[model samples]
Target: MLQRGGAHHRRPRAIERLVGAAKPTASIRALNFASNEMLFLQTCDIPSDITSTEALGWIGFDNTTAAEIFERYIARPDPTINPADLLQYVYGHISRLLTSNLRNLPRVQAMRVVGLNKPIRRALLDPCYDQILWTQDLHFWVKDTLKINYATLMQLQQQLGNYIHQRRSKQKQKPASVHGMSVVPPPAAELRHWQPEHTATVNMIPEDHNLPASHVTVSASPPTIREGHLMLYKGRAATESINQDGPIADDGSISMEVLSTCPGGDFNWTSPAQYWTPEKDVAEQFRRWAEQRCPYSETWLLAIQLSPEFARGLKREELWFSRDWKEYAWYCKKTKQPLSKFNHFWNDPPAGADLMEGHICTGVTTAISRMKVEEIQDRIDEDHVLQVGENETKAKQCVFLSAGAINRLGREMRGKLHIDIYAAIQSQEFSEGLEAIALK
Candidate 1:
């Protein structure tokens, strides 16, 4: 019976040798171990009663069977070995088989060896040696199967760590401010100049009480990705001047010619009669002009331009604009109340409207009127208190002018033209305006 059993095994071994020696095509060599000969093995009449498990038992190989074999091999008198040594042996063997089969190399060759000492030390010789060994085997199998190397695996690990850290850092960051506060970095590329056509209201107010008065608010809504130069203009005078010219020049200069007429000089300059009346009407007229002319222009305004020195002094310096005209108007809204009656009249008022009428008349007069009411509301909502007293005080001291022109003026005047605008404007309007203003 023993000889008969031995003879049966020899028959299978002979068949295996024949199959191994057969000249396989390139495609057949590429076939995986589970696929190439599994069907043929199944088709062969080894035994009708034998299951795959039984067959594996007969052959002394399978998932658990391989581990058992490895354990038995490790349990010799020389079994006093590091678990990683055994793991290295298994990994090396599998890697060799995979490379040899996939590459269609000679039947057998010396396998590539990978050092496990470093990894074993890194794993700290934990009690979960079996789990670690299994994991390493799986890793080696995948690397060998995919034809990758240790260096590639290490690189993948490093990339995975970086990705995880980045995600965690983003999650841990504070949320964006609800008040629309953002700390934007300075633009790195050349920015498109702000266009007047894109203008949106930040505040508005009516020409009512002289105490707190009506105010209209305007703010800039910058694009998601902004580049190039930016300008921010505070006070109605500066803003109106910017609207007339187009978006402020990158260096903050306003060209008198550009202000007088539209680009290409196609549109004739028509100073709206109602716009330049009583000084109280200035704010409303400016709003109307901005709405009519500023929208659709290709320019970008930076909050920094409005007050450069103030922006520089900020803890988180960034260019931004407000967009709360409705809120501002609501805050400024008031019911009719008794007031001291006053009377005034005008004559030959800029070639439009009766001086006694004291009302602005223009194509955009309605928009200006509504904006004036909103501006007063905004101040009332803000409690008529200075939000940034020190910054406001400093900004008042600084003058609004083209940065490039300022530099040029300084160079021409040998830095003698460093006087602030309120002082200069008080002394002489034309000289101060000429000294500071320029066109792109």
Candidate 2:
């Protein structure tokens, strides 16, 4: 039975099935009706379960057809009708139908408003009309899907108008000065000449061994010299030790203090001369790390972390080595740690499970022959203990468990102990039972 409004409408079950299967055909028909007038009736005839009234209700005539239909509706004037009122009524009804359904909307409205002789078109499109006809069906569609009501739609239209008006106003208000003026600023005023009272001085001293007191002479004229300043010798050479060997300490070992200060006038130059070595050669370290970690069973999970960071560094060495590193490394920058460190293990499945089985499980398993299940299970148990210990020390931390591990534990309890795994785990009894078995 097909229900319409509150009544049961007699409709064949087979027809309903056929209609469901024919939805694509119906959509095509609807599209055709919008573009072609003759195809409209053919579409209307396709649905045998629908009455002519129902079909007509959905069939929206385009503007040309609506105007013609409206004229026909008005010509048979019963004495009670005023022509003006009748025309308005026909226009409103046709316009409402035209706007409501997607199948009939803009195309129909365009055909109708344009089809009305030129005078009618001018009146409908006039700014004086003020009210635009809109379909309740369209209003309902918008309200249901996007929560937009008639009042909101009107507000949006007003906002659009304001935006357009503001843009036009701005366009008209650009500065008139910008139109004719040259863009370049005038040249800066010429700089005034200024000179310092004291000119720069050059001072140099020749080594004692490089000159003889007898040969040196004082002169008022600029001295002829190369590379160093010449000093006027007015007196006998001062008694100074001219040590042939580079200056040395009394103990015969060269003193750092004397070497630095004596040579460069109290300057410490060791810091600038010091060599630097990195804490870790990231490329070499990553290469070795990748060689060791890449072939591991957990490589996929590791690659997820390593690949990105390796890429971010843009180093060929980092890229080559971390390529096989399973964990995503780039995530560490945003997360403040490598993916392996930040991501909860329990939130992800064991790395190799996907390859063996179609899906990853989140609990205990009975299947053990695939690999060293016992060894893996023991490692998982130890990890859980370490996690719990950490959690106890850090009260706010939450521990994550892998789905595969949890699934295996669940299967073990249910199969061996005959316990409901969900209830046991939820009640915290599963851990108690495991403790008992470990102690035994």
Q: In TM-score terms, which candidate is top? A: 1
Q: What tens-digit string does per-residue lDDT give for candidate 2 at 248-287?
A: 2222222222111111000101111101111112212222
- Give each model's whole-structure lDDT: 0.23, 0.21
Quick one: RMSD of model 1? 39.2
Model 2 misplacement above 4 A: 1-70, 81-84, 96-440
Worst 10 residues of 1 by lDDT: 1-10
The lDDT leader among the candidates is 1
What is the per-residue lDDT of model 1 for residues 241-293, given as tens digits with 9 covering 90 to 100? 21122222323232223222111110111221111111212322232222222
